[model samples]
Target: MRPAMLIRLALLALLVAFIVTPETFAPVFQPFTKNGAPAIYTQTSLLSLTLSHLAIVAVATVAATLFSVGLAIIVTRPFGVEFLPLSRSIANIGQTFPPVAVLALAVPMFGFGPIPTLIALFLYGLLPIFENALTGLTNLPGNVSEAARGVGMTGRQRLTQVEFPLALPVILAGVRLSVVISLATATIGSTVAAKTLGEVIIAGLLSNNTAFVLQGGLVVGVLALLIHDAFVMFERSIARRTGRLY
Candidate 1:
C-alpha cells in the first residue's frame, strides 16, 4: 500500500480506538482539565456523536452536489446559456451570508434540531460544488467537444457519455472541498441543539473543560483529513484512467 494510505489507515484505527474507549485516552486530556476530576468526555458516546456528525455532513453535501451539478449542467447547455448569470448569482446567494446567520434565520421556521443545520450546511456547501461544476463543464477542449458532436451523438448522449465523464474529476474536486468544509462546519449545529461533535466542544467552552474541546476538534480534524485523502485518491484514480496524468 502507498505510504499515505497506510498513514490514513493508522489514523482511522486510532480514531476508532479513541471513540470506542475514550477513557483510555483520558490521561492525555487530564492535564488540561479545570476540575480535580479526570478529564474525559464521558457524558455522551463519542462514537454516536461522530456518526451523527458524519450523517449530517453527508446529507448536506449530497444535496448540495445534486443541486449544484444540475444547475451547472443546465447553464452549460445552449438553451440554458442565457441563464448562466442568474444561476451563478443564485449559487452565490448562499455564500453571501454567513452560515450561522442562515441557521439563526432557519431556526424560527425549522425549529430546533438538524433541520436548520441541514439547511445552513446545504447552502454553505453550494458555491464550491457549483463553481467546480461550472469550471469542469466549461473548460473542455474544443476538439474533444467537437469530436462528440462529429460522432452524431445526441445532446443527451454526448453529455452523459462524454462530457459528464470527462468533467467528473473536476466536479469531485469540488465535492471534496464541500464535504470537508461541511464536516468541520457542521459542529456549529450543536449550538441550536442539533447533535454534533460541536456539542462536546461547546460543553468544553461553557464549563472550561479543555479536554472536551480538544477531543471534539481532534475527531473532526481527523475525519476531515481522512475524507479529503479519500477524495484525492479517487480523483487520482480517475485521472489515471482518463489519461489526464501518467
Candidate 2:
C-alpha cells in the first residue's frame, strides 16, 4: 500500500478501537444511565442516525449539483452575463444562512418534521457545491471552450461533453464538504423530531451527562471522516477515469 494509505488505515483503526471499546475508557468517562438502552448508547443508534443523515446529504447534494451546474452554464453565456453576480449572491446567502434557525422557522409551515431539517441541510449544502462547480467549470482554459465551439458543438453539447466532465473533480470535492457538514449538522434535526444521530447529543446536553454527549459527538466526528474519505476516493476514481485529475 502507499504510505499515505497505510497511515490513513492506521488512524482509522485507532478510531475504531477507541469507539468500539468505549468501555476501556470507563475509568475516565464512566457509564452513566443513558436514556436509550445500554446497547443503544454504544454505537448502534449512532450508526443508524449517521446512515439516515447520509440519505439527507445525498438528496441535498444532487439538488445542489443540478442547480449549480445549470446556473453556471446559463450565467456564463453572453445574454446571461448580467446574472452571474446574482447566482453568486444566491450561493453566498445559502452558505451564510443559519441552518438551525432555518429549520426552526420552517417548522411552522412545514409542521415539525424532517422536511425542515432537509431544507436546512439543503441550504447549507447548496452553496459550496454550487460555488465550486461554478469555479471549476469557469476556470478551464478558454481555448478548450473555444475549441468546442470551433467543432460546431452546441452550448448543451459543449457543457455536457467537455465542461461538466472537466469540472467534476471540483464538484465532487464540494460534495465531500457538503456531506461532512450535513453529517455534523443533522444532529440539530432532533429538536424537530428528525431521525438523526443528533438526538443523542441533544439529549446528552439536556440531561447534563458528558459521556452521552461525548459518545454522540465522537460518532459524528468519525462518521464525517469516513464519509469524507469515501467521497474523496470516489472523486479520485472518477477524475482518473476522465483524466481530469490524479
Candidate 3:
C-alpha cells in the first residue's frame, strides 16, 4: 500500500483506540471523587471559560491574520528586504517564548482569570500565522504575478486580485495549524484559571479523579478533530467552488 494510505490507516486506528478504550467510560478511573452535588455542573460552570478561550482564539486569529499578511506584503519588496530579517527574528522569538511563562507574566497586568490566557494564546498563535502567510505570499507563481503587472495592474490590485486569491490555500493551511494549537493550549490556560475544557482535566488531576480528566479530555479531543475536519471541508469547498481544483 502507499505510504500515505498506511499513515491514514494508522491514524484511524489510533483515534478509534483512544475513543473506544475502557478508560474513556469509567465512572471514576482513580482514587478520587468530587463532593456530592458536584454533579455535572462542574463541567457546565466551565463552559463560560471554554467559550472565553475560543473567543481569544478568534480574536487572535483575526489579529494575527491581518498583521501577518500585512507583514508578508511589506517584506516582499527589494527595498523591504531589510524587514525580512526583522520579521524572521520576531517570528522566531515569539515561538521561543514559553507559553506558560507568557501567561504568568500577563497575570500581573491582566489580573487573574482569562485575560492572561488570551494574551498568551495570542502571542503563541502569531508565529505560525505570520510564517504561513509569509510563505504563501512569497511562493506565489511568478508568471501569474508578472501577467498581472504586464496588464498594468497596480501593486494593490495585483495583490488583491491575483496574489491573495492564489495564496489563500497556503495561508489557510497555516490557519488550520493555529486552530489546532490554540485548542490544545486553551487546555493549558486552565492552569491559570482561564475558562476552558482544561478545567475538567485540571480538576481531575488535583483531586486524582481520572474520570473527570478523561471526560474533559475526550470532549476536547473530539472537538479539536471536529474543528480540524471543518477547516478541511471549508478549504476543499472553497477550492472546488472557486475552480482552484478540477
Best by lDDT: 1
Those runs of model 1 whose alpha carbons end farther than 4 Å from true positions after fitting are none
Q: How close is candidate 3 to the true structure, as a TM-score?
A: 0.80
lDDT of 3 by residue, 33-116 (tens): 445423232444444545665676777677767777778778976668788988877766548887788887888888878777
Model 1 local distance difference test score:
0.91
lDDT of 2: 0.76
- For model 1, residues 120-222, the per-residue Cα lDDT tens digits are 9999899999999999889887888899999899999988988888888899999999999999889999999889999999989988888889999999999
Estimate TM-scores for all models. Answer: 0.97, 0.83, 0.80
Candidate 2 regions exceeding 4 Å error are: 3-44
In TM-score terms, which candidate is top?
1
Ranking by TM-score: 1, 2, 3
Lowest lDDT sum, 10 consecutive residues, model 1, at 237-246
Better of 2 and 3 by TM-score: 2
Per-residue lDDT value at 218 in model 1:
96
Whole-model lDDT values for every prediction: 0.91, 0.76, 0.71
